[model samples]
Target chain A: MAEPARGAYRELVRAQIRSQSQYRASFAMDAALTSCVSVLEILAILVLFRVTPSLGGFSVREAVLIAALCEFAFQIADLAVGNIERIAEYVRTGRMDTVLVRPLSPLGQLLAGDFPLRKAGRVVQGLALYAAALVYAGIDWTPARALLAVTAPVAAGALFAAAFVAGATVAFFWIDSGEFANAFTYGGRTFGTYPQTIYPAWMRVLFGYGFAGYQPALALLGRPDPLGTPAWVAWCTPLAAAAAWVGAVLMWRTGVRHYRSTGS
Target chain B: MPSAAACPRPGPEPESGSDFGSDTRSDTEPDSGSDKNTRSAPDARPAPIPFRDSARAFAALAGAGFRRHSTYRQATVAGVFTNIVFGIMLCAVYVDVAGASGRPGGYTTAQLVSYVWVGQGLLSVVCIWAWKELAERIRSGDVAADLLRPVDPLAAYAAADLGRAGYAVLTRLLAPLAFGLLFYSMYLPQRAVTYPMFAVSVAAATLVSFAGRYLVNLSGFWLLDIRGPISFWMLILGPLCGGYFPLRFLPEWAQWLVWCATPFPSVFQVPLDIAVERTSSGVAAATVLLQIAWAALLFQACARVQRRAVTRLVVQGG
Candidate 1:
């Protein structure tokens, strides 16, 4: 059983890679489409700088730096995962039954598909934006800062992946149409592109409100927060993501258990 | 012995119209649709009316499309929430950059704000820059049945899709248009005549976008796998078409590059510009000409290709 489980994981990964390669042109195009979307969003920030230089003490370069960070974090988080959206479909079609019958944990199977390798395109474009921020904005990037920059994307990706997994896990129970749910998953990343400082106070309070809510912002521009932010906000993006992911895992297990008992 | 020599090769044309020649994927649904909609006296059928003659049909379609869109009231509001929140943040940044007083290239901060809001909201419905399903239908050859429909295939798809697009306009599009006006204090036309003109321009944009998608989708007929074309075009033109952001915000070079390549801004920018009346009369006339030209060129090409497809199949008796 254990051997077969290992074999299945390997086979699924191999198959996914092969499938992606088979549709190389399609994969490339999807990557390019996503890259263009991110670039368009970035252009919006560029337009902001055109009329004047300073945006409340933030220069055009600085704003772009911030936008770049947001884009980077968003690309990493949003693009890296695809399988998360299939939860309802899997549940509805009894494909989940195959996972249940398998020796390996279904969570592992879910995770395997959830990580979209095609997301590499957005990730590259995002990294270019972040790099531009460093060069064009002339940031003081010491080795420590560079290492932190590396972690920023990984952390953001985890955070975004966690949000998607949580959403997918929730859909396992209701089995309702997940159409509107995309507005949450993709929309959150799109909404997060701008600095959170621009958002309304009530909206700020509703979601992350803190620097943690704006990790892409922080990892980008390190938003100058008066509420004792700089000390730990940078670390919180990954921590919050980890916590969210853990919570999502717990939820998924609960949903699975419910499925087992309900036998639906 | 060569494997080819061992077994006789099947010709491209099938022996019978009823039977789809042997194909792989033994599990997929076979015989999806009949080859022909009109078996005998095919010319007895009325020719498909040109798009110009379809005004009554167009208006009826639009009206029905509007009602169809309004049906998903909940989905509409949820979409509004995301658009408005993002609009505020984006507006804040641009306004600050525009400086203390309103005005950049003759665009006031308020006007620009409103433009961004309406432009952003209308963008979702006005331009489907990254249409995925068209390629899907073509790749799977489900378009075979779509071809047999009595009405024009592209028009039928447009009629149905336009409803959703119209819904995007009413709920998603209007929310931001109104939000920009009320909350953001956006610019409005002085004479109020521009409102109707804006409506006209917007309707034209929707149809053009639909026509553009049909052309893109028609690629699937010739190319069994259309991922290359669809993906490539989507990557290049999706953002250029004003889906993610406005072209007014793009760099001068990008603006010029995108303007000529696909007339993406004509979908969202030109209409919004008409409302503000920034375009000179000459440019406005030119813009209108370009939009019509693109719509006509793409629409005609689709018809020609579809006709050729039918002729080939019938002659080959496949």
Candidate 2:
């Protein structure tokens, strides 16, 4: 059963890629535009840093590294569950009935359908920014640090994807809850780009504890918090991510059980 | 009824109620005079009698748009909450960045707070998100009917959008500003001239923004899918219009580029400067004039492009 499900997911992705390739011009334009937008955001940070040498005691290079890691994790998570945004559309158009009748889990089916190749632009941009930050930040880059760098974004991506799933789950009750979800999903991405110390204590507590992106960003940067957090806390990213994922899965199951299908 | 018969049907129902002209006919149905004039003779229709006919038409369409958008109360409330959340986050960043510098980029902490909050309030007003309704209508062949209408499509759209902006100001704008005022030490403009100048600038900015988006949506006539251009516009315009940060924070050379190249700065940044007293009254007055100039220029450009597009549609028998 697992093998067949994996095969079906792979086939779905393959078919989507093939269809997307036919619109190469549109795809290239979209990808370039996405990258351009990401670059503009980085430019805003550079402008800010021009006036001030440090943001919350982190050097400009460290700040950029934090932003890149946050963006890298965000783009990866976006690629995974970006289709969740369409759940509201599905509900509105009564297409949820089709998914309910399918043998596969509705969440699994959604994950397989509509793979967003366009987001590759953001991932590529994030990688480039990450490399630049790594070179400039003058990190010691020990084996452990290098290993942490590689794993941190993946963990952060899982947590962010969980945020997406949790947000999508709310669509079962309110079809137009994208903004509410965005307050966490996109909001988390924005918050993660900055050092958590810059925020008010209450904000730091809310985002840092409620969302998992903050820990992983600090872990990737190998930086202790300006707010007096212990260095060992950086290593807790994976645990935080796992906890978030488990919670997201349970919430999704409840949402699925409670979903009264909209008629076709 | 010949022109009505000739008008092509929009293919398939649009998925969302946001689509333009979806309920436009029904809203305009009670105004029997204009409906008779439009249906009776397309070519023989008299020149528009300016204020009487067009004014009434504009008011009716604007009222419908205002009422239609007001119905989305839940979306408005959610948007307000999101804005306040982001507002607090942004205020924190600005405060942190201004630490000990007193006034980075010549803006005091209070001024910076006011800038962010005002920018938030004005965001939906100068929204750069290309209204995709026109583009979708063009793709679905619904624009054929739009083109045959006795009224100029550009004017009609501008009127409807003005109504939408009015509604947004009441629902979306005040909450964020009030939130900022409550939490932060926001700077209010002290000069007497600032209030009227800011009002004029905002109205002109809305019209200018509508014209820019109108041109973008009109591209759907040529490009079957316009998502690429729309995304590009939002990305470029949002920062240029100072939605992200005060344009003054940018280097002088970049500021010059914004001033010379685009009317974008007039959209949000100008009104914001007036509100924060960042500009002298002379400069504020000049900025308002610039917004009016952009509005007139862009509205004319929209009319010209629309004429060309409609002619192409007619020639191609769309």
Candidate 1 — which pairs collide? Answer: none
Candidate 1 lDDT over B1-318, as tens digits, reads: 000010101101101121111121121211123314433445565555434335444445455555655654654664565566556655765576566435665677766676667666765576444454555655555556556544555665576567667778767788877877787777766756567667767777777777766677666655545555655654554455554444565678878888787756666667767666666655765676677777777678878877776553321122
Candidate 2 lDDT over A64-183, as tens digits, reads: 777777777777888888678778777777788888887787888887787877777887887787677778777776788888778877877887888889878887777656666766
lDDT of model 1 at position B20: 19
* Count: clashes, candidate 1: 0
Candidate 2, TM-score vs. the true structure?
0.91
Candidate 2 per-residue lDDT over residues B207-277, each given as its tens digit:
99899888988877777567676766776777788776778778999999997789899888889889999
Local distance difference test scores for all models = 0.59, 0.73
DockQ agreement of candidate 2 with the native complex: 0.37
Query: What's model 2's interface RMSD, roughly to a tenth of an angstrom?
Result: 12.9
The lDDT leader among the candidates is 2
Residue B86 miss distance in model 2 (angstroms): 0.8
